[model samples]
Target: MTQQHLEPPVAAGLPTPVPGRAAKPSMRELILQAAAVLFYAQGIRAVSADKIITKVGITKVTFYRHFPGKDDLVVAYLERRAQSERDAIEGARRSSPGDPAGALRLIAEGIGVESCAPGFRGCPFINAAAEYADAGHPVREVVASHRRWFKATIEQILHEIGVADVSGVADQLVILRDGAMVGGHLGHRGDPQVVARSLVNAGRAVIEYSQAPD
Candidate 1:
């Protein structure tokens, strides 16, 4: 019998001898990922490329090799997140299998997960914007585009559900999601899923009430 081991994807892309990290990620990927975590955890201005290289356990040269600079890495990180959000929302829609309301509930519930993080810091985009509010950095533009897409997707779902005010439902859900993220970040120690469930329930109640025959 022959046994096989697999070399990772990034392994074929970069020089060996770099240590740590799970996948032996390429310099560009490493820089993107480190920026993702640090900027997500501590805001972009608060974290630097130096910190990313140090956290990645890679040389400064390795950092520069992948990303021209931190701004480039920031854009890459948000691009990755934008892709992920699209995938997750698409997955949630599939999970409900023709029930947009169910999918919306699932989406909200996941975002407010109490165990997701300590000091959660809300959405990565919101956190980054708080830091670069004046700079209009690459990160800000990426975040802005992502938020628009997300809200639009939610609106599409509401429209499919026959809601009269699709935009209103989407905007309301966005507020609930963001508010729960902040609540979970601050005073809430209990299961954020409970708060998440309540958000969905409230929306459902409004839908039912509006549709009730007079």
Candidate 2:
């Protein structure tokens, strides 16, 4: 497991408050952060609101003030994760302006790095989707929304790369990424870096295949 997993959940990234010095996190952020850690480590359904309240050292009143219900907290947790992912992908694009392939490579590398991290447990979206089987559920909506954005992003990149019929290719690339994440977490696919390279290569192959003459 990663060092963060080994540490106390509530203390994962909390700063040591100095005497009259460090700025304290707002009660909302503190509660949300605690819930994010637990929800990611343990399944969302497995971690309860009371557990989050206890971990944050807050009363039911305070917890409810920030999040009206467990679903509220779960949605917030997923939205936070989704924002982080969006930022990462945008950053990759910015880092490789006008170069779709380079941005794609950076994206693969980022996923690879996450897989190699200790306590990696595959994709957060996938995990959440598994627990939330209802199509109309809020959590599933969040997952579906994020996935739509991701697939559209890939489709845009492929279009820029001169690949025709990118719809199927984009789907293939996303599936390849999903497999790579799981493979990296399972550690049964040889070295972690190899798994990452395979993702990049597989992505490129899909793009190239779509670009080929009929």
lDDT of 2 by residue, 71-188 (tens): 9999987887788789789999999999999999999888877777767777888889999989899999999999999999998988888888878998998898888667755764
Top model by TM-score, which number? 2
Pick out the ten consecutive residues of candidate 2 with the lowest summed lDDT. 1-10
- Once model 2 is optimally superposed onto the true structure by TM-score, how far is the C-alpha of residue 210 displaced, in angstroms? 1.2
Candidates' TM-scores? 0.80, 0.88
- For residues 1-214, could you state the per-residue lDDT of candidate 1 as single tens digits? 0001121233345566545745455656656656666776666788977888888798988778778787888787667767766877899999998898889888877775642445565666666677677556677888788889989998888888888877776787777777776675566766667766777787787666655677
Worst 10 residues of 1 by lDDT: 1-10
lDDT of 1: 0.70
Clashes of each: 0, 0
